[model samples]
Target: MQDSSRFDNVISRPPASGDIVPISAHPAEATSAVLHRQIRHDFPTIARGEGSYLVLDDGRRILDASGGAAVACIGHGDGRVADAAMEQMRSVAYCATIFYTNTACEELCRYLVDSTGGHMARAYIVCSGSEAMEAAMKLARQYYLEKAQPEPRRTRFIARNQSYHGITLGALAVGGHKTRRQLFEPLMPQNVTRVSPCFAYRGKTAHETDAAYVARLAAELDAEFQRVGPDTVCAFVAEPVVGAALGSVPSVPGYFKAVQAVCRKYGALLILDEVMCGMGRTGTVHAWQQEGVAPDIQTIGKCLGGGYQPIAGVLASHEIIDAFSKGTGAFIHGHTYQGHPVACAAALAVQRIVAEEDLLANVRTLAPILSGLLKQRLGDHPNVGDIRGRGFFWGIEFVQDKTTAQPFPAADHVAMEIAELGVAAADYAVAVYPGSGTVDGVSGDHVIISPPYNASRAEIHTIVDRVARLVEDYFAAKNAGGPVDAKL
Candidate 1:
């Protein structure tokens, strides 16, 4: 056996001046070689995870309320998924797609396609949501080319404002998150145009009905198509429930149907990027299932592998697949780790667990409780602007004036402060997903509370209690001229 005493010394050793600090402490100087997301911030080192709680090196257990960006659906450290990945690795770990296909990949793909209930005809697995989106864009373009009457002029794409697809160039080009795309604006494709997002809280007028709002949005899309020449459009992309960019903002009722109708009218394909909100995050396996419409191509990730492995996929409709099969008989795009065996195995295991345990049912059951508790606790708070989401995915938006719905300035970083405070308080150490640019991509703040699908009722209560306390305390401190930073 390995020498266990060797680790005892390291574990018992006192911290040096430059050693990494706990979640609540801030190191004066940078000590690590790795380039973290924020160079100035000191992050806690997680020792291990158990279900809804993440234990730090300092022995404090934090509640993973956001599931690390809503990715951990089955929760952390699921042994069944680990075993499945190990088995796949032992059998055949890395087989190039050009040479051979592994059973794990095939099985995962088949399972995904079947879950779609015939809406999505085929699945093309990739390593991340960005890659899947890139693939979807390429395939959408290729599908138009493979048509009986090729419309070479159909090269333009239309997406929404305050939307995030992915990080890669192609995905970024099609995305509308202004802060993310600001520096890379010159590099983004000029063919892509943007429309207003389907955010009811901000987009809808006081007197506008849902039907009228949908009609107005649809008309705007139609007008954009006309402005750019209808024959030149390739696709219209959106997310059923906006994630990160607008804080889990679900579209108004009939919005997707309206947009899909407009896309069909112009012969442009509909591509839904469900990277942050798909794969059973919002009760249904696919977010579009709740809506009355479906996209021609859809990209999903985050919860797909349940954070066990990196995996995402493009789900193509039958109509698009038929065009490809009848013409090129292949998708032209490729990725180095397409349909990786171990990733596929892990995802397959995660998905199987979701199905066998009926976690979607759990999501459906708990969604109302989460929503109700959040509203009951934080609804009357002066800064709490909105509480919106479906299933386990929810966002609490902060505003300076609730009546006016005016968002706090981006400079204040209210969402980040609340998130940091949540992580710092040992009594209520809960991690939430913070987001900015909720209003027009520069000036709003919100935080997402996306618990794991298997989180118990007691866990949900704890999450709400902690998060509500964090929000209340943060704003109260800020209003009273107190230090609101977690490090303070």
Candidate 2:
């Protein structure tokens, strides 16, 4: 029999205090051919992944607590997904979507449409979340043109501040993430407008009730629509749960309903970007379900493929599809790899596994446990200002002064430090996603903890424990006036 202990023993021990480890700028970086995200930073080379742990080439096991920005919903190294991809590749790997539709793509689209209980009439599969958002924006424009009256004037979009939709030029224009949009402002489409997000932690007043806040936000959106000439607006874009741009920020009660009403009033479609928070990342398969609002056009990714393949999709409502079916009978948009069979097959397999294993139920069951433990561990910490999220998608916002809820200066890079230390230190070899601009677009820091949907009770506890210890020790060191360096 093979020794299972061989892999387990790799991460059995932690380095002693003051031991120096090279976390960045690996020796291979000097002549590495690949252009890494950070030129100077040396990333660990992963040999393989097993369940929730990533085994490095050097034989160290690192716990993947954040699921690599909440993409790996089913964890790593599932042979079933690989087999599905292989099978699809063996049959037909590359077929231009314009020329032909494959079984895998058709099945996956059907599955997505059914998942929405037929509310979404069609699914346009793409390669990434950015492409999905781009498709959604273009489709929204086409939707207006497809109408009987041909409202060609509908060219503008209203998106929430501190919200991210995608990275492409079109998607970036609609996104309100200040930092990401700053350099690209001159090149972005000028048709998009901004409105205040429904973030209760910062946007809500101390004296205001949830209902009052919702009304205030709705009024702001309405006022913006009027200011922009509602007839020119194509849609109101927002993230069901604000992802990277604002950490895992969820809206207050009745927030979506209020916004949807405003959108309807202005004859604008509601586009909810669930790239990071949907597909069972939250308790529900679709985050908008929890909000009690179904978007006219929804973009889903990340967990859609569970990191098994590069796939994202845009779901269109029946009304939009009907308009298209009657008008041009074509979307007038195309991508070379729109519905690659291998990608669709991999995503289909992942989604089936999620449903067959009943992972959403697991997520719902563990949501409270994860939230309770996080609050119990870091709720009262001097620097922990807020802990908010639903299901496994939680975020811990760090503040310079908890009483005043003042964020640490942007120069401090608090979130990145915690994330880097979590991966660098042998004592806490766990990974969490970091966000820099949680407060506005330039200041504040928060870390997202999005465990896999199929994560066990014990795995959740382990994740929380490691994260809490990292937070506590890091702050303790800061309080002691020490360097608080992960490296020696």
Provide the TM-score for each candidate, comma-separated: 0.94, 0.95
Instruction: Supply the TM-score for candidate 1.
Output: 0.94
Residue 412 of candidate 1: its Cα lDDT?
Answer: 71
lDDT of 2 by residue, 371-442 (tens): 999999999999999999998899999999999999998766677768767887888899888887788877
* Model 2 CA lDDT for position 154: 95
What would the per-residue lDDT of candidate 1 be over residues 228-329, giving only the tens digit for each residue? 999999999998998888888998888999999999998999999898899999999999999988889999999999999999999999999999889979
Off by over 4 Å in 2: 1-22, 26-29
Worst 10 residues of 2 by lDDT: 1-10
Worst 10-residue lDDT window, candidate 1: 2-11
Residue-level error in angstroms, candidate 1, position 194 = 0.6
